[model samples]
Target: MKRTLISALVAGCVGLASFAAAAGTVVVNGSTTVLPAMQKISETFMAKHKDIQVSLSGGGSGHGIKSLMDKTTDVAMASRDMKPAEVENVKKNGGEAVRFTVAVDAIVPIVHPNNKVKDLSMQQIRDIYAGRITNWKDVGGADARITVVSRDSSSGTFETWEELVMKGERVQQRALLQASNGAVLQTVAKNPNAIGYVGLGYITKDIKGLTISGKAASAETALSREWPLARDLYLFTNGQPKGDTKTLIDYALSPEGQVSVKEVGFVPVPAKK
Candidate 1:
């Protein structure tokens, strides 16, 4: 619970004509999927700005929206956009919501390294998650139970699943609930019977990505909006930020932030040009 001051760590960039560290405290929450790169930005930004305090936390996008609505956090980092009703709820609760694009992410479907299934279409994935296709044999893999590791209800990844695959239906009672994307990746990587979806950043050597309808989940596809599962990552603020919140948001949208986006394995916005 040590407090970190932004200006103390981010002073060098003050005169760079990018983001001037304005004075004040800002709290950011949500998007554990993007936390690694976001945290990198926080460390670098804090080095250049000393007067502002920045606290970072993640409990998934749902936590981000909840904290914003309750007026507990100044910024919400989201792996996905807010749902329409969620936006309305924020306004009804006396909060103003504005979204800023921070980066791009893909929902990479993955399997254990040994699984022979290397490709799957979006429809096939949806069917698998919907309980309509219950075995790997049905998807051109081994004849296994096709145990699914899923982000818990509080996660934005789960929300994406509901919207894109489940089409608003509830998750089956048997879907294994994982606390975070990392956990899902870990579980799926270790369990041959497991299949899971994670953010592009979390797609690593431990688990192999499955091509979606012959297209791969990658930065190029994500930036071009070519991959059907690609999504724009976000930072949400309550109304317009005028101080440190604005500063951090500006830095995140700036070239430096986009570079960090790429460094952490996500597709940088604007294709890093």
Candidate 2:
């Protein structure tokens, strides 16, 4: 009975294995950062192709890659590129992991709207997350202790943050870890002293997006790779997609689908001239 509802958008937190593919169904699983835009795109895709069903879910990027190697999902949405070991694992399964860039994203640091501190230097951000700077006053805000919010390790957003922001240092043990972008957003939005990072698409009025090192996060900066935390969003398949899989990927990269990407606050892949 639950499977009959496959055409409807399902929660990203649901277990991936719970979904069984039918003849015309396409199972998409992966990064929560990419989930919102894909949800919008899938709705448009399904509307035009009434005979097809698209099931979307999120469990972070690693889970999506694992599902692809396990032959459980048709398409894996990721906010970061596949690591070499992940690619090798697919080869062991007699398949090749192929990536299609669907959009560009900038990981933006966010804080509660009332937080007076506006911009943070890269070194200052590193210090705060590393616990070197524990109070908001240390970086020019109130004297209260700062609460650090972070995405769980399995997330691609975490991996990107670790690479571009943390460098060699680790986030301190005291930091609160959330499972999804939406979780991080809500946690920070409710706490005046909390600071967290999320994909640019997740930025909303509930929280204020902070400029990192004097550069604001925006589509122009992300598309040009001028933003320090900018990265490409991807759709990965077990191999060169065929049949319905190819059709879906094609539509996602089409101009029409790119419009949906922009509408969702992500930077669309530049069209080929």
For candidate 1, what's the RMSD? 6.9
Alpha-carbon lDDT of model 1: 0.77
On lDDT, the leading prediction is 2
TM-score of each: 0.86, 0.94
Best by TM-score: 2
Q: Where does candidate 1 have its weakest 10-residue lDDT segment? A: 1-10
Q: Over 4 Å off in model 2, which ranges?
A: 1-19
Question: For residues 79-112, what per-residue lDDT tens digits would candidate 1 score against the true structure?
Answer: 7888888889888987778998888888888899
Give Cα-based local distance difference scores for all models.
0.77, 0.88
lDDT of 2 by residue, 1-273 (tens): 011122232453455333557788889999988887788788899999888878888889998988999999999999889999999999998999999999999999999999999999999999999999999998899999999999999999999999999998999999999988888887998999999999888888889999977899999999888889999999999999988888889999999998888887899999889
What's the lDDT for candidate 2?
Answer: 0.88
lDDT of 2 at 23: 86
Q: Give the least accurate 10-residue stretch of model 2, judged by summed lDDT.
A: 1-10
- Give candidates' CA RMSD values in order: 6.9, 4.1
